[model samples]
Target chain A: MNSSHLSLGDSEIRIRMLSQVYSASYLTRKKEREEKSKLLEQLYVHDVYDRIASDFEEQQYQPWPKVKDFLLGLESGSLVADVGCGNGHYLNVNPNISVIGVDRSFNLLRAAESRVPGVNCRADCVALPFRDNQFDAVLFIGVMHHLVSSERQVKALLELSRILRPGGTILLYTWAYEQQKRKFNGQDLLVPRYPSVGEDNPHCNCHRPTTKSSGDQLLTLPNQSQLSVLDKLERIFVRPFNLFINLFKLNSHGDSIETGESKDYINSVPSTQSDTLDDKSINLITKCSNSIYSNTLSHSDYHYDSMILVPKEFRVREFPASSLFSVSKVLNGKVSVHKRDCVSHSTNPARSRDDRFYHVFKRGELENLIKSSKSNLVVSKCYYTSGYWCATITKNTL
Target chain B: MKILTHNMLTSNIIKSVKDGYPLKIAATEVQEVDVDFNPEFIQRLLAKLNWSVICEAITQLDATKDIELPENLTDEVKEDEDMLRKIHHVLLEVEVIEGKLICPETGREFPINKGIPNMLLNDEEV
Candidate 1:
């Protein structure tokens, strides 16, 4: 699916906001719960990964040494499965062993195909396509946290056990709730990802907005005395990628960039729910954007072409008029970048549009899920390493 | 999809379906690529593979390239270098560039595009 479908119109946004929380009566029904969970999975985990696959790979990702060492130690010609193998980097960790990697996102699988051709496929963790007792070992890293619920986490563990040979083992890794850099208020959180929207620096181009105005320029943000606040807002929203530099300043300088009420907006606790964008500053931006969008309705030329700056697949994506308008406000004074310590703030994307869902596992959470699944997969080694909760579970021969 | 990977796939995940082993392959594009022939690796993997499934996949992919083998691995065949090399060729060298892995019991077809089988089922199917 292209990003066009994800561009929320006024009515759709309201509907989405209303449906964010399930009513107690609605939660009582099993079918509704299933539907809601599926929606959450699509909106947060599956779709976000697909959207960010290319940008995700561009960032330098060094293979975890412990995971690589485990793969290197495997016997030659051993059939291994790397479930949730993003970019398929581990497929060639040991040339002697054969590893068939699988992932949920087709785009990610495509990326993996580019790197390690003919070794990866598209498959879900909970419902794998392999037969019973198929693999000698399985690598299930950074996958369980995206399952969305405890039931799914347990279900995925059971599925891994089913495909593993009796004497084989599985190497699992997940994000830890207790982290040294970031403090999470709850187990579930949505982390932001900043994909370079266009080139590294949009200001490097000649169209870089300056006080010196010329009629020959492609864009004209002149200081026309008669122009209303909304008119100036439209021009800013038109070239919204420029707003990132200012957002970058806000993040680097901390509270210095914003002042007074805007500083309070920056200090306020970030909302945990992905759908809830009701922060005081965000509402103001949305209102400004919606107004500009309505005014531009009569004049088609004034419409912001987000396609010029964003990739074809991400054109008019989560950052439609509503979110784009907010970018201008964010640049104006209000800082809305969620204080996410888990991911490097250096590359944090606009939190309003590109939040990635994660369900951080607590201490013993992985063990509890395995035990509750009633599988013969016993935890061989469990420990915390480099701010992640990791475990190695072996299927019992008996 | 390689014959080695296909042998271990099943449609047993489908509702009410059991014994989904030996998925039928309808290959549109088949490519034979060179791989280092290791007789020992072939012999070691022979114990884990189902002989008939490999034969079935070979026939389905290209009937002209079929080579008959016994239902189970014999001591003589395991030791024969020529036979092991042929097994290695069929297992690793031959790849289905584009195809569909059809579930034998349910006729559920999983498409293989750019040589990677998309085994993901719809939410309702799961």
Candidate 2:
């Protein structure tokens, strides 16, 4: 389970894309799931929320006008879906909104469930088990594009449509075709709206007016297209967290996310269907994770370095390559949670490789991806990297 | 193989347009292969499927009773493998007997017949 951080703006986009989906964990055997839960409890939202609220405490995210205008127009008390709702970050940060947080990560949901208490947290997005027309509005924030294909993406969107009361909007924030390439934790997956891939401005530290009021000094955000995408996503998944401040109330005063040290979920909860992450899987994960780690841990990447068995015990061994290539073991890395959850304790030698990750292609290479994936019916607007901006197409157009 | 599974798979070429996955399946050669049902394997496959699409596909074949999902871990679900076996029949047992899978995003079509889908694209698609 990788808790990769996405840009706050893109977070809105990515969240919208998947709020309707659940983690893949619900589909696994009982024993494997429990182990994953233990690892996840460590990352529960109760913890991440407090940290984010504190870290970004200096600067709050004001709901964008487009999203605000849309929410304000909705029937005052409507049901909304918050896809990839991480610790109810959007809810606590914003105001006057209510949403059901749906995410694929257990640790994330634990935090969301705890932070927003009473909210539902199901796993997996691929096949949601909900009946038709169950919700009034489906809003996605920063998570849809991860679905990886048009057929699946369309099916997901259609599922959102099935669950929605007609006229309800699905909010979305996927990687625009022109946006830079994205990575989850460290794996590259031609994704949209990833963490700051090629952004020159992390923060301008400016302020703006939320449709209701003025004088809120917030970070000068990214472009309008990015903001507008979040607005459009409400048509698809959950309303922006900022849009419904009431629904995502938080306990802010450092309440332990866990209910008094219970590792009970440690053994039975199903984890999201991410790649099998045994040591070998982790080892394989490292090879495809990101190329930069190749240098520092060239030696540690090979040896029978580590063993990870919770999701199902698997050994991490060094994969070999050619002689001329200097790099012997092809895989050597660690899956980290914001790097703060360090794992140097393992007998394995290859330490965390966060700093090593870099953009796969220069501006030029990424640009080519965008240009190539483009077609007549699809209008893709890219930003940084040149990858194809993926959007589901209608049968009429296809 | 049923044309259903053919529609969802695209070859894993990681490069070129993302459309050519599991290779698209164009029609004309559709077949209903007879194979033994393995409920355990079907359950495992179900564990790995894009369920929504698979369900949509199964409906296209025989929209009989609503998909019979287990209400609980009943003997019907656990021991009788028929439920799983049918799922297997739909997912793996069936082939693109014929037809192509077109990328909704891209108009590229991969034709199939006799269970083998011809996903070969012109030099340009590559």
Candidate 3:
């Protein structure tokens, strides 16, 4: 056969046909979809922040003590940059050092400006305007988790490293998915925004309207008094079942010793918030109602009133702490993702749904991130305080 | 935004811009505010600064007369209290109230209004 004719043989034709079927257009569309999703996620984050700006500002009145301590430790007259400086509470913490605050929200920047005029700027954390190596100290407290994607989180850290001078200190804080106090579902969550009575319902004390059945609303009430005799009986059966599940979990996992310890820690805490068992029992009852109470109550009614107070519009992303390991494998030894609690069992009815997406950090996630970035940052101190994983890292002089 | 901060900032954060550093400054209004003079802080900062870039930035602002810094740091210069104060003034006191930071590579202009530089880029730029 001639060389040209042989080249167009059966295998070549088949390969050509396969290439034609899955061509450049398919790959391009996939890329476009990814870009669109990222854009949508960014918009969602910004929209939620803008909507909750006022209430969020109110909630962030006090800077966490550990963050304050980090700020106070900076040398007098040192230049400091507070990335995601919500309401500029930390900017005003020390007058000795010059702190320039940057945040994505204009309203939050305005709030910060009101506290310390001319020191606040509206800027995204990913692209700060300040020159490289400008800041002697940089603060990324409660900010890293807000960057939904691992790529953005790493990019932000690199950007931070770029802006900080070698030997300069960086203080970082983020919510830990492995906290002893709280539990969560998936890392990415859309937490509900419960409106105050005046905002959602002007005439009544209850934020939600009372148009639903009184019996439905009664069951949803967190108070024990509102629980019907049937719910009380269900709770009795569900509690032991929850303990059994806990025991099962302990037996299955090698790390059950630590889980048992945290369970005990939760049990010892006397606050109403510590009644995580009740949350588990309630969820169990809701789940097993078909088999346990087939004739007693309708399953649909149990779910309907439970989420009445949850606003449909507002949602926040919760990122899983475990995902950090995949994002930066070099951090594997330093950080460990621990399952502390389940979201459905949260004592706070508002928090039960895990509406907020939290990228909870393991204890040393920040240190690992810095290390993985290969930046000059060396972890000077790392510890958990005030329900946050905080670390103070200093840029190393190499 | 202080010229000191301007000195460190670059518009190259976007993927399209390769060499975003040394952004040309077009300042309509410049202000000099009195900050506490700390020689020690200035000395520490000098090590991190790009002296040649700072000099070029000073020329762009036409404020070379206001602040004079040497091109290189020597042991004597570090101890010179006068030079440290001058460096301190140039770094912290000279604020660009209104200006446009033009990216060297992409020619993208980031506006600075009321001393806050808006470094945010469009999605395409990102």
All-Cα superposition RMSD per candidate: 16.8, 26.2, 14.9
Candidate number that wins on DockQ, 1 or 3: 1
Please give the ranking of all candidate structures by TM-score, highest first, separated by commas: 1, 3, 2
Note the DockQ of each predicted structure: 0.50, 0.01, 0.32
Model 1 C-alpha lDDT per residue in residues A304-382, reported as the tens digit of each score: 1211111112122121122222232223365233233223333332332345556666555566556546789988777
Task: Give per-residue CA lDDT, model 2, range B45-93, as digits (tens).
Answer: 3432345556545444433125554445444554565666656555544
How close is chain A of candidate 1 to the true chain A, as a TM-score? 0.56
Clashing pairs counted in every model: 1, 100, 22
Residue A82 lDDT (model 2): 61
Residue A295 local lDDT, model 3: 31
lDDT of 2 at A315: 23
Give DockQ: model 3.
Answer: 0.32
Off by over 4 Å in 1: A1-28, A196-352, B67-71
- Candidate 1 local lDDT, residue A138: 97
Q: Which residue ranges in model 2 land beyond 4 Å of their true spot?
A: A1-69, A92-97, A180-398, B1-126
TM-score, predicted candidate 3 vs. hidden true structure:
0.58
